[model samples]
Target: MHISEGVLSGPVLLSGGALAAAGTAIGLKKLDYDRIARAGLLSAAFFVASLIHVPIGPSSVHLILSGIVGLMLGWGAFPAIVVALLLQGILFQFGGLTTLGVNTMIMAAPAVICFYLFGRLVHGRRAVALPAAFACGFVSILLGAVVAGAALMFTEENFLEVTLLIVSAHIPVMVIEGMITVFCVAFFRRVQPDLLPGARVADMAAPQERNEA
Candidate 1:
C-alpha cells in the first residue's frame, strides 16, 4: 500500500503529512513510558513480519500482524507502525519517504479502529477473543487497501485497476495475518495474559459490571 513519491500532488501530500504528524503526536501523548520498550520490540517484529513475502496470483503479499500490535499496544499502534515503516523505507526502500505519511495512516488508522472495536466486542470472552482478533486483522488489511484505493482515485483516473490489484494481492496475506493474530493472542493469553491491553480492560470492566448487578 505504498504510494510512490510523485504520485500524489503537492497539496494532498502536504495535507496528509500534516495530519500524520498530528496523529503521531496524539499517539505519543497516549504512550506510556513503561510501554516504550515493548512497543519498540513489537515494531521490530512488524518490520520482520513484512519481509517474508508470499506470492499470490499475480502479486505478492506479506504478513502484517497489525491486529496483534493493536491488541497489545492500543493507540500506540500509530508510532509503532510509523517506526516500522520508516525502517522499511530507509533500509529496504519498500516505500518512499515522501509518501510515508499516507502509507502509515493507511495502515495505522484501521489498526486503531480495530483495536477499539475488537476490544469492545471481545470483552470478558477469552474464547471469542481470538476470532475477533483475526477478524480485526483481516479488516485492517482490507481497510488499508481501501485507503490506498482512495488515494489512487484522487490522483489517477484509472484507480479502480490499482485498487483491484491491491485487494487481490492482499487476500492471502490477510488470511495469514488473521491466523497469526489469533495464534499470537492465544499464546500470549496462555503465557502472559497481563500483557494484553484488551484483557486488562475486560478484567477491570467485569468487576464493575458484577458490582452494579
Candidate 2:
C-alpha cells in the first residue's frame, strides 16, 4: 500500500507528514530501552517479510506483520514502522520519500489501534491472543487499503474502483498475514513470552530496574 510520490497534493502530504512526526514522537516517548533492540530486530524482520509476495487473481500481495509488531511493541510500533519504511525507501525505493508520511501512517495507524484494542478483545484469555493477533493483521491491511483509497480519491476520479481493487487484492494476502501472525504469536508464547507487550508491561518495573542495573 505504498503511495508513490506526487500522488498526494502538497497540503495533504505536509499534513500527513506532521501527523506522522507527532506519532513518531509519542511512540518514541513510550519506548522502553530494554525492548528497543528487540523492537528494531522485529521491525527489520517485518520489512524483509514484505518482500515475499504471493500472486492473487489480478494483483500480487505481500505480508505486513503490523499486528505482530503492535502486539510486541505497543505504541512503539509507530516509530518502528517509520524506521522500517524509511530504510525501505532509502535502500530499495519500495516507497518514495515524499509519500513516506502517508504510507507510514496508512500502515502504522492500524497497528497503534490494534495494540490498543487487542487487549480489550483478549482480556485475560491466553487462547485469544493468536486470534486477536490475526484479526489485528487483517484489520490493519484493510485500514491501509482504505487510506490508499482515500489518497487516490483526492487525485483520481475513480476512487471507488481503485479502492475496490486494492481491497480485493488484499483478501488472500490478509489470510496469509493472519496465519503468519497467529503462528508467530504462538511461537513467541512458547519461547519468549516476555517479548509480548502485554506480558512485558505487566512485568515492566522489574525489567526497567534490571536494565538500569
Model 2 poorest ten-residue lDDT run: 119-128
Each prediction's total of clashing residue pairs, residues at least 3 apart in sequence or on different chains, is: 0, 0
| Per-residue C-alpha lDDT of model 2 across residues 87-174, encoded as one tens digit per residue | 9988988877788888888888878887887744433466777678678778877877777777777667666797789889877767
lDDT of 1 by residue, 1-213 (tens): 577778887766776777678778888988879878888997898788777776667876667766667777778888998899898888988888788888887888778878888855544476777678789878888888787777777777687898789888877778878777777777877888766776776577889999999
* Alpha-carbon TM-score of each model against the true structure: 0.85, 0.84
lDDT of 1: 0.78
lDDT of 1 at 126: 68
Give me the displacement of residue 150 in model 2, in angstroms: 1.7
Per-residue error (Å), model 1, residue 102: 0.5
